[model samples]
Target: MGDTHKDLIFLIPLPGGRVARVPIDVLEHYVDPSARISHGGEAEEEDVTAHSMSVDPRTGASIWHTDWELGQCDYTDENGFPQSAYAWHRHPLGNEYTEIYQK
Candidate 1:
């Protein structure tokens, strides 16, 4: 119920057509999640406004429902600077059914 306790998670897009969900605690020391998110390169980037993700931490069901203008993207760059790959999903702890992006 408080923002102070909120946490962040990262979703990595895989070339094989599956998303990898990694907890922020496991990546914060090496990766920046924000740097990997963006509205595509369209003249008018499609805004990802509604997202519904539920993870039963105990069961580890990291599935999500996101409403956005879909596009293809690469998750990591050649330098691995956390590219905004079209396959990642972020889970901001405690912000249930949160809105992740605004076009």
Candidate 2:
């Protein structure tokens, strides 16, 4: 029997206000994780907000893509009551592709 895996999908924005539903497996095949900027801590996983880079089939230029990260509330409300909590905080990871391209 073949191995079974969960389907992880990401909605990526395109050039003309269009979006594409891409699979995690496809992104992994094209993008190199080490090539991109690092974020978060040891407890944080690259498991969220998938980002990747790939070549445009038509233009033959490299393009960086990303999905939305899950948000959470970690602070207390104005009433001084605990609102909610997040497992971890998200950090800004700049575009490695753009930096390289601009050079």
Can you write out model 1's per-residue Cα lDDT over 1-103, one digit (the tens) per residue?
2344236556865545667887667776786332323234442244343333333325544434343323433234456464443443443343433222322
Q: Pairing residues by index, what is the TM-score of model 1?
A: 0.27
Q: Over 4 Å off in model 1, which ranges?
A: 1-6, 32-103
lDDT measured at residue 51 in model 1 versus the true structure, 0 to 100: 32
Give a tens-digit lDDT track for model 2, residues 1-103.
2344437777975443468998778887888543432233442363344333333445645543333222342334467665443322222243431111110
Tell me the lDDT of candidate 1. 0.42
Q: Residue 26 of candidate 2: its Cα lDDT? A: 86
Candidate of highest TM-score? 2
What lDDT does model 2 reach? 0.42
